[model samples]
Target chain A: MNLKNIFKKDNIMPVAVLGIICLVVAVLVAGINLITRDVIKAEEDRKISESLSIVMEGGEFEKAELPSDAPSTVTAVYREKNGKGNVVTLTKQGYKAPISITVGIDAEGKITGAVITSQAESHGKTGIDSYVSGFIGSDAAGVESHFSANHVTGATVTSEKIKEAIYDAFVVLGLAAAKDTPDVPEFTPAGEASLTESEAIAIAKELMDGSYTKVALPENMPETTHALYKRQEGGYAIHLATQRIKWSPTENEAIVTVDGLGNITGIKMIQWNVGYDKELLSAAPVCTEEYLNSFIGKNASSLNRVEIVTNATLTNNFFGEALKGALDVLYPVPIYSIIAIVIIALAIAAPVAVVIINKVRRKKNEAK
Target chain B: MKQNNKLSIFLRGLIAENPVLVLVLGTCPTLAQTGSVIAALSMGIAATIVLACSNVVISALRKVIPDTVRIPCYIVVIAGFVTAVQLLMHAYLPDLYAMMGVYLALIVVNCIILGRAEMFARKNNMLDSLLDGLGMGVGFLLALLAMATIREVLGAGTFAGIAIPFLVGEGYSYTIPILTQAPGGFLVFGILIAIVNKIGPKKGEKKRKEFSCEGCPSAHLCGKVSCAENTELVITSEPEVQGTPEGKEGEA
Candidate 1:
């Protein structure tokens, strides 16, 4: 090829233009990166410092080198300069997603305090602050053991995950002995009912008075072992079923009583293997009477206001689903449900309307 | 070349060539970020900064940039400005940076930036290009604000996260949750386009050809045979052909 052809307008011009633009852009980007890099680092450092202070109160924090082979969950460790405590940032898998916590553990092998740095769980409903505060006075030696004894009702998964993370931190510090717990079992389809259908019907009849006729549960109701029933007095009864623990194979059922106005009047734990086991049953009140009473006045829309029982998060969530199922049957005209219908209708109709309009326009054009 | 008046350069983007409503450019980010007023504002500002900077740079280098490689050159310049903006936002307004997410980086590919660069910036003076970019940016911002206001107020029952009294709450009754989702974005965008089309200036005969490649912002860069250019070529060549008796006889 001729040297003149190599520098010709078509061949070299495109390459030169692109090369020059790329060079200019690269230089500009590099200059910006240099200017902002320190500021970005400082912003991150400020955030960490803020979290450290919140977790370990009344202390100045200096970044401490994390020990090699630190648990994967442990992101950073900070030593309290003026105090005998260290703030460890740990990320553990919560119910919905990873929950990041900054935990302060004093030299005495006791939790000073803990603050949730980041969490995917809904803020208000998780009660994570209260759960973390519970660990303030607890010994770190067996923090995982205390989870079962003091598990927060509505925030069970988040609470347990936080406990496990703190436990790992303690084990890292040589304050606690590490013990492995089996991973919780995934939810399975409902199996054979522990309570006979006749027995459930009899219980439902007694709760509301009058002959109860068995009815099919509404679509998309929570897991149920027994068919729902309606009383002659215009109230409904349904079996709200859930597992005793996340890992448990056996199913537990609660008889939810809903009045004509869609309010949950009562809840009774009718069938649970844990209820039958005297030793395990004595550990904690799984669903206290007061806790069940808290749901009494709440309807489907106001179910969010129902306070979760301590140590009964999974059970209450299951109960909440059951209450929702009852309300779905009672007050089927939810605001979201109506919106859903409208959207679906529009989705189906808009395309059809367009096609019809086009046909009409085409016919008019043909006539003209 | 006739120097375009600065006011026309600015005013044209607001009405005649409104980036989102009229031109129908950069619809993706416009719809996605319009779910909230703050998000839309942040997106609009970020996009505007990038647009203005890219336009000025492209206009300044217009003579130097070879015609064949202009698009890639424009892209690289736009991408640089976008990355710079991203870094600054990340450093100073970390929250808004996090909220804008991928959409901020996506400004590199936004057609409005490249479209303006190819059509207006490459031909116009630097000052005019800068004004054009600012005008288009403000037009996009106004469009986003309009869509976001309706969507946020109706869907979320909030304005910039502040709860709108009477429109929200249990006793007051009525909030459409769907308005915050993707479909609501389209609905609001379509309505705004229709309203803007009705109230804004009617398209002149010249602008009626906008749908064709002749009026396309990227038509010159696309390297396609534009009808307007072809017609002009024929008209200009026709007189020369008529001067020759043989060519006139062939045309007749």
Candidate 2:
């Protein structure tokens, strides 16, 4: 091939066009990158500051250089301005994804507080609320055993992973016992108490007045199931019951308070087992105090008529049924009796109407 | 070529040639980012900015681009816009950038941007191409929002992370978790496409005779037998056709 022909009009046109376009695009991208570099860095710095404040109880943070031999889990260390503690950010392998926790360890090596900055653990909320809370007043040496003894039963993996992060913080502060020591023990709590029967009774007592007294099932109310507590005071009875929502595997236990006039005074969720599925659990609205308070002032018969929470429809519906069941035992509306009477009336009216129609038809036929 | 009206040029991409639902382009990002309403919305805006910017630049340089190297030229321009958008999002909306993950960078290869460049921007004026890109971008955003709404509402029971009061509560357990997963993404995408197909313009209305070489942008440079034969026939017949004036006059 001739070198001159290679650079001729036919070939060079395409090559030059592509080269110019590439050059222009590269210049444009480079210009944008230069402008955004500092801003991006600042944003990351702000996130670190926020996480530090949350875990360290709101104090100014100055970045501290990590020792060269620091463990890989210790991503960054920040010293508190008041000299109270050091906030250590650590990343540990969770059950599904990496769990990042910012832990504040005081100068004396006691954990001040710990907050999960970012985590991919499936049941993180329950773990954070229950197991991670156990670390607040514990020393660095006691973290492993405390976690092993009080791990959130259903969220064992997540609890253990959080413990690993806390242990990594211990290593950073030079408070750990030994490098090769196991972080989490194999002990698991047998039959963890999510909610106990006595706890449900206590919640009912709080919702009702102090004068309420627990009573055995009355002769007229034998059909009520899951009724943990039945209290009667001033001609009113408050019943606390647990009812499973239809189509849901979990059950919601609630206390329903009723007045003498068959009106629901209050309702409260004592305990609930929303499923272990992460997406479903996060999406399922917790039966909060404000939500249960909305059921007050409505008659038991009108429980289904209340406004349903948008995403918590099934939970709200379950609360309604539980309240309705409790009210049925007290008021005995006799919905079945009303239905039977209506059917009997319809059965008698149908034959009489048919006879009158036949007599009119005979008269018309005779005239014709 | 007859110039399209400004409104029709902008509106056509919204329904007639929708990049996501109608044309079935850019399914990777559509499925991945649509697990949440916020993620889907962020991806849509980011992609739209890139698409519109790339279309305008490509159309402006259309005259300078040689046909043989058009695809590479278009890709470079598209990738530049994508990188710029990614950097800007990272700097300003860092949370959204983190949430979108790989899909934001993946916009460079998203077929909608390049497809518009090749099929419309390369042949059209800068203004028309800009409008086409905007319309297609908006169409893509709408399709994503529709899917995200269904998935987030049914699967996660939240609209943009704000819980819907009716769908959630202690005793309410009717959420279908599968809608937020990958299979749900495909199901919602297919349903949206079907709905668009039923309501939008009828298919096959403009019938063009498609030859095999139609898909090759540089058909003149192709060394295939069919291309060579066609070119040779045209070259050999031209002089004879010009010399035979009596043959043309017989019809007159």
TM of each candidate vs. truth = 0.49, 0.51
Model 2: per-residue lDDT, tens digit, A108-180?
A: 8898888765543433233455566678867866886763534654567777777877888888777884444
**Cα deviation of A293 in candidate 2 (Å)?**
71
Best by TM-score: 2
Q: List ranges where model 1 is wrong by over 4 Å.
A: A1-4, A53-65, A71-73, A79-368, B1-4, B168-174, B201-252
- Candidate 1 per-residue C-alpha lDDT over A199-294 given as tens digits, one digit per residue, 9 for 90 to 100: 877777666666677888666664543467787677787776656545345566777776766766767776555433435445555566766677
Second chain TM-score for model 2: 0.78
Lowest lDDT block of 10, candidate 2 chain A: A184-193
Backbone clashes, candidate 2 = 21
Q: Please tell me what DockQ candidate 2 reaches.
A: 0.24
Chain A only: TM-score of every candidate? 0.45, 0.37
